[model samples]
Target: METVRTVCTICPSACGVLVRRQKADIVGIEGDPESPMSKGFLFPKGLSAIEYMRHKDRILYPMKRKGERGKGGWERISWEEALETVTERMGKAKALCGPQSVIMLRGAAKGLPDILLSRLGNAFGSPNITSMGFLCFVPRVYAYNATFGCFLYPDYDYPPATLVLWGVNPSETFPPLFRRILKAKEKGTKLIVVDPRRTESAQIADLWIRPRPSSDILLCLSVIHEVIRRGLYDASFVERWTLGFDRLERHVEGFQPQVTEPYTGVSPEEITAFLGFYTQGPSAIQEGNGIEQSLYTFQMQRALYVLEAITGNIGRPGGKTRWGNPKLVERYGPLFTLQDLIPREVRERRIGAERLAPFAHYALPQAIVQAILDGSGPKVAFIMGGNLLLSWPDSKRTLEALGRLEFICVSDLFLTPTVMMADIVLPAATFLEFDSIHMPPDFTYFAHVQQKVCQVGEARSDVWIVNELAKKLGLKEYFFKDEYELYDEVLKEEGITFEEFRRIGFLLGRKEYRFYEREGFRTKSGKVELWSPDLESYGLDPLPKADPSSLQSDPSYPLLLTSYKPYPFRHSNFRQLDSTRMLHPYPLVLIDGKTAASLGVKDGEWILVETRKGAARAKAKVDDVKERVVVMEHGWWLPEDGTFLDHNINVLTSADPPFARETGTPLLRGVPCRIRRL
Candidate 1:
């Protein structure tokens, strides 16, 4: 019998994995059947974990850049030399700037963020720490905090009365959750998928609606207006629990179905009919029905929150609502450095307009890059988990800003395009080979343990690396220790031992429901805040409205471009994996059938995707999936075309600030650009 315990690092899903190892190496990876979260199922990436390790571009040991950055020039070096160089540069940076000048930007790596983020800035006395979340989920978290005073994460197990799958395609991103949706479907629950493209999840849904790109705010506002106009909303709930319903009502009064049809390309009555599924037919329609959406995404999430709240679906078993679970203080990985053990500053110094872009003003990286490149923003950048250059709103300009970083450090598995530019690049252990603990869904309270399977070279867990660096910076005496010792400290607080987590791969307790309690919501007033004090403090309009105000599209930009995550990929990783890469080996642009026909373009041919900032070439995948939608997976390497495709795609994307009112989560899916045949 082979012993194995692993976890998927493919994406944030963090699904529990069970591996079969021979001697000291892993031979196979599968979903842990023992896991209550995954139920023994795995995503494509999880099943092909071994194959990913065998990819061509994998680095086996520590290496230093030997040539000009981004030239793929590297020289293998000892870990001592690597650590020394990283510490030297960081020390010099800490000396020149008041620690606040240095910025730590990390993404997706396991168990290291809190440890590094909390300590790195405070030790240096800087609050400029940011991550890929600065570009992704932080906005959602920010909105949830501002609106409901609690995060109402989508609960797959919650018995929803009417399910609305919007923007997100969890069937690919969260395959395990997809099964939960399927289970709901089996129980005669209605399914509705809303997206700009005819995604796999959308194709199989009971209703699929592809509205105009970037028009989600308008589309949702219409639904709310219709629900209110037809008296479909739960009046008692809105009258009692909501704030600014009157102001919000005034905003949506003029946004009738007919008014939104032109702006959103969604017919008035079809939108009306869709609204009917949840809000009509007396108790038969939604009394116990669920109105769960796939994080609707962008401002769309804000709009969906309104629908759920007005319907009294909130805190109901079968409706969307907020969850409150005990934080997994125990088994949550140890604080790696004494510097990090120091509590972070609670003053919450204003994150400023640029910092607020993802949370407040959507397309912020464009401006953030401009400021950085001009030496106007935070001068030093330390990136940890995420690859921002490849994941920002405008990839092209992000690359340019990356080149201008006075000091940059990245801790990542592979030397990504962005990593190539780092002054210091730390090696990170793969997920299957890390010893850490986490709350799978960051909003929930379940704890999953990630234990090592095989020694993949000498890469260290990020916790170790951050601790090692802090030790060099003379901050070790506080709380930093080798992982096991630190783990013991963390374990002591939770009544869980390392032996317990290692044996079970997780230490779980009885799951608690977020809402549906006999009492009421966990809000300040004990009722969900459709109106809240936080929103008013943030100077945000305290009402959810369909405010789809378009930025003036230049005539030069004739089409709308959006990037979507594919089934077998995460960020920029695994493109080199044979099993996964075969699905769509290279970046291919998708165009609507009508758009292609009109442009004298055919499927599977080279085309030029151009915007004001730049242009790139790609093969076309013409389909009727979306009338005017064109998409390409992000983070494709510069060497993609026969080992060097010049189409970095980022150049053509807009570097403008995001288009959100209170939150600035960039509508990356609705950027403006036109595709032309090569």
Candidate 2:
């Protein structure tokens, strides 16, 4: 009984599945109905991938920290003494605080160990790697590469005649794009949804809208000021491929919909019936991580790419298209993260690259926990597969900047609450025990081949722990001569061999709609910058701007908060899988039944919440959401009662200082907070 097939690298919807195996005992996991992008639809965290790869708190080997650091003590060591104690504490923290003090920390995007942890921090010269990409999906991929230089996605094969769903729910974080938007809402499209919770894709929306929670950039500049005051743009593709349409129509004419309806609780006839069902034609929208955990994340993703380039919906056909990527696979930028072997003053010392220097390729988990609580950051971290003490924000200032780290390590599988502040843990493996090349995130333009169906004890593979910690940190002439010679040098420009990409299990790529009408929009004004001269040459705000004092409300934190991703965890991973904690057992929150009966809360009780950076608890349900909001549920922890930071909603978030100044993106949605009845 073998079965095998492959793909589910847990999250990033790399679905596909199959597994079964009896010889080395996986014994079942299904889905792969010939996956052409999750067609066999398997979620519940990919059918509890064999109960989260045989969990019982998995972590199969390599240990160490027998004392201090969150004291659950360890010891069992040996993967050559946990790679010679993480190569002698990262070679004495790169010989006394130098390889930019050694940072790394990654999470989400577990494929090719996120380009082998940026090729092990650019071959150990370090540029402070960091992740949760400024509140996920890299500030909507740096506001779709500063407006229309790409990242559009959602073509769902040309069926959309209107789909919106902004602040996305894709029915619990993308169930294969909510079963292709429920087969394009049974062929008539026009769904809408916007979200301030009531979401099972807003009870099958044909218009749901809810606004006010970080007032989605004043409800997207009042729906781009009533779609250019009702002309409903796309005026011949904004006069042949836009570029600051009269400075984004005089900067969204001071956001109108009746003066931004009491700060976006939406109405001006529901922003003119959400621009009459989104400019009535080839629409698309999608947006999510609820406007990428706002503080106007890159100006609400550059006002949803200037509302999909003035509704012509950039590159048409069910709109927002532009796919392609398999011209022989080797992607992940700056030459697969070797980044010219780190120079330019050691990549300008990356701890938040002197104020988001165009997202200095990664450092900003709240500016490396405020530069490791201000001793100027990174005194050794490494992390990988993160939990950043229940997913970073302010869990009491990320547990006091990871207890002011002076060497940490981690790599996971479970022991996580940021692996009890590790001093070396390791284990890892899973996605059915290793073999690589998955791909499948957002643009779903395919790549496949995640084979390895077995191995458990002595776990490994985060590309064999970054190729044996780049050969004990001497960086081994910049890594590779292993993990299938790093998957045959990323499929050596398609000559093949990673066993012919696991017998061509997948590769797909070529969709190509109006690629900016034959090579335009890559920016520096090759069209579609809609008021961006590259964000006024990176000093930012060349267009999308809407503060409204960051949606006011703070009569002593009078309830706002937000958070979601629940369909049985992925962020802080499968709560020690009892079949994905029996399909999400506790941590709930929700609220609005008249603000949980004006705060004397009820539905399954429990509560608490709080905020101006603290407080946690959970339980309450109350539902239908919006009035004075609430929501909760993101990646909470229980792991069979180890209870990390008591139901961590990033211990009431707040990585501080305004943020989204072009992707330092902090706020983690709406925020304020208050609740109680615990």
Candidate 3:
């Protein structure tokens, strides 16, 4: 037996891992003790990596649809035949409807697959490459970039004396970060959690601030108002490293705690207490993706940045900090450069480009569906590593739009609902079966060299598949001979090598603080822009606002429905794995015991969760959630039982309107809904 250092790709956390193999077969998996990041700890998902890779449901070979779309029948086909068929169909579609008619979408798979998909679209002269970024971290990244000139990451090395976790459950979604938080807590660090539901992290928090769903903007603004009103802000730092402070002060005057109390469900005293605790030196706020799925996402994130800046936590040792040394992997170096390969005319033809501005570079899933329904969307689509029907909101409409597509190709490890709608399916290698690079989920500091431990059946790495496709499409310049060649090209400027990276397992430089002191913020003003002139130029608000009145709840659907990822699953993945499934056997709707009792719903009983868009069935799980809030499990599907049509939360989510104006992000949280016993 031999042990190889790698990284877990089970979820976005991408923790360092050690894979044990016996003559080409994976024998065991564990956390890497040598790595400083995770420090010999692994989540249950990481420990079950070997079993997940060797699961019986894995698609081992390429297959072609033998019957109509949505039919379960398929015929095994060689990679060559599959590639030729896909290339021919794509070429035909492009020839008839221009390059803009072919769209490339990436799913949950990280690293090479996502980049290659974007590169393929660019090289093929299509500008409609898109992914889950619209629903994930892009809004926060964009907000930070616009406000501070660079994205600031929470500094966990020297954790803050007070850390505020807003709308994020690091304990479940991010194990490494959770471990760091736990260590900091052991050392007397005060924890403040903000979420509608009582997450595991919130259970032990020094203070749990439960706000109304989608009302985080009001809460953040109220805190900012209190800090300013109490003069708890850092006057020295504000005078030196910030711009438009006076404008921000005046802008937040209307968001005082009393004014926001009804909307945010936090009293003035609580807001003042929060400010008093957070204003103490060495404080940090770790924003999560949950807020990005809410209404006014971009504005909400900008308000959080403003809060950090006013408190002098911008460059503090235990606060939000700039990125460490550059990552070893060039996540989008080629794709960034290749994006221009698509001509200006084709680029302008991108769906939703006219309205979404900065986010126009990628196709909007909602807009893609609308376009398809109107016969103006891309005629052909290539999807990799995701379940479109399950992940995208308005499931029924998305499915129908996909059905209308002229051709659909999916590359994944299993036949999902989206794959069932595809004309061709390509087998993809799991993380353990590929040699690549990985970084932690948010605020990434280090890059880990993912070593291939075993190869499963005929599954191939995404890089290999893309390379072959590039060759078939006559895009020789974008094709790499092998993973070695790709890695060499990526590390050419850094002078590092794949061999060195593999041996070392990780590449991270010493942490640097007070980056703004030297170079200042990377904004147009060369300082932290409390009020952004760039936003004004784009016809958006220069200062963020908390307009709780913007969202009017429907009396028919009184309760606010939200969603959360199960601790044992990564979105829709791992539901078929017995070990993982045993941890969370079914989808659940978490409600307060009082609310459950009022609705006559008992724990473990099946309940119907209905929204304006659709409805789904889930087992009721009584929790300490707010009376008006209901937390629904995200990404639910039962492949083994062949009942893929039920239990997914997106079925009840709408993709229609009320998106973050700047980012085109749909409101995945705070939707009006009602629940009844099923």
Candidate 4:
């Protein structure tokens, strides 16, 4: 038997794992003790990667739809035929309705596919590259980059005097970070968790503030208010290293804790105490994707960044800092590719650019859905590594918009509901079967080479499929011929060979602390802009303030609904895997026991969760939570039962208008909902 060291891409945690395999058969899998970030920690999803790779329903060959779309009928086809048909159809669509009529959509697979798909679309002269970015990390990425000239991430490597986990439970989304927080707690690190639910982290948190849904911006504003009013802010840092502090002070005059308490549901005393602890010393704030799903996501993130800046945490050793190669200069791989391909005319045709241009670079998925429904959108689509029907908001509209596409192709590991609606289904290799690069999504300092362990059936890597399709489309000059060539290209400037990277298993970057002390922040003012001049030019709120949520509730629908993904599952992936499924057997709606009793609903009873848009059935689980908040698990679909809308959470999520003016992200979280016993 031989052991292979690789990183797991099941989630953004990207834990390092050692796979023990004998020839083509696998023995077992365990955490790599030498991994600096994960530090021998592993998630259950990572352990079941082998099962998912070897599952009976794993797509191993290319197939063409044999019946009507969404009928689950397919005929096996050669890779050559699949490539030819896909390219020919894409060409036809582009030629008939211009390049803007073709769309390339991507999902969770980050490293190569995420970058390559946009390049592919732009290389083909389309500007309709869309994903979950409007509802995910893109807003934070843009907000931080605009303010700090780069994405500022929490420094988890160093212990802080205080750590504020805002709207995120590391235990469920980021297990490695969760372990790090636990270790920090052991050393007397003051922990503060700001979430509506009593999460695992909240159980041990020194302070847990449960704000109302869509009220986090208020909480953050109140934190800033208390800090400034109490004169606890770092005066030296603000005057020397930051711009617009004076503007911020005047702007926050009316945002006292007593005034914000009604909007945020946090008392003035609680707000004062939390900020007092947070401002004591070096503190780090870790915001999660839960905060990124609201209609006010961009403003909310900007508010959090302001909070971090006022406390003198920016560019600090134990606070918000960059954690990558400081000396590395050259850009390579897909990052470089994304810049060179798109022409200006095509870029001008982005779907939601009119509304989201200031805050985001890409088109919104909801805009694409609306365009398709109105018969003015892309006629063809190439979906890679995502289940749009199960992952995106409003499964009904996603299906309808996808069904309208003249040509559709889905590349994935399993035959999902999204796959059932495609003209061609390309079988994609798992992470274990592909030698690729893994960059931690949390802005960590290291990168790992995920060496291919073993080939599983006839599945092909996404890079290979993309390269082959580029060749078929006569864009061969744009892509590398092989995955190794791509790897070498990405590492060409690093002074390391691909073989050396594989052998070393990782590449470490020198940590450069207090980066702004010498070079200054790379913003318009060359200082941290507490009140953004860039935002002011666009006539948007320069300072972070609470905006009313897009949706409101009346007497008919009185509860607030927010969606959460379970730890064992990554969006819609791995639900068919028995190993992970055993951990969470059914779709659950988490509500307070008191709320359930008041509504005449019982624990473990089937209930109809209804919103103004739609409704879905979910089993109620009573827990200690805020009475008005109802949390439903996102991406719930059964392969055996094979019903897309019956129990899926997206049925109740709206795909309509009143989106965030900056990011075009619709109201997925903080939606108005109600529940009744079924």
Q: How high is each candidate's TM-score?
A: 0.89, 0.34, 0.97, 0.97
Query: Candidate 3's residue-wise lDDT over 504-542, tens digit each?
Result: 677775566998888878898998999988888888888
Candidate 4 lDDT over 78-171, as tens digits, reads 9999999999999998788888888889886466567667677767878788777887888887778667777777766577889999989988
By lDDT, is 2 or 3 better?
3
Q: Which stretches in model 1 have alpha-carbon errors above 4 Å?
A: 109-115, 280-299, 322-327, 330-368, 377-379, 441-443, 508-525, 638-645, 658-663
The local distance difference test score of model 4 is 0.82
RMSD of 3: 1.5
Ordered from best to worst lDDT, the candidate numbers read 3, 4, 2, 1
Model 2: lDDT equals 0.80
lDDT of 2 by residue, 1-678 (tens): 878788887767677888777787776788888888787878777776776777778889989787788776888778988888888988888887688788888788765678778888888888888777778787787778778766778676577788888887877777888898888888888888888888898898878888867788888888887888878887988888887788788888888877887776778888788788778878878888887877787788788888888878877788877777775445666777777789877687688776684544777777788878898757888887788877788787888888888878888888877787888899988877878887755554677888898888988778888788887887887787778887778778877887877777878787677888898889877888878876787777888897786664788988789888788677777777766667668889897898788768889888789887789998999989788889888878876656778888988887778776767777777788888885
Q: What are the per-residue Cα lDDT tens digits for candidate 1 across 309-384?
A: 7877665556655544433443222343333332344213423453342234222344557767777655666677
TM-score for predicted model 4 compared with the true structure = 0.97
RMSD of 4: 1.7
Please give the ranking of all candidate structures by TM-score, highest first, separated by commas: 3, 4, 1, 2
> In candidate 3, where is summed lDDT lowest over 10 consecutive residues?
327-336
Off by over 4 Å in 3: 327-330, 333-336, 439-444
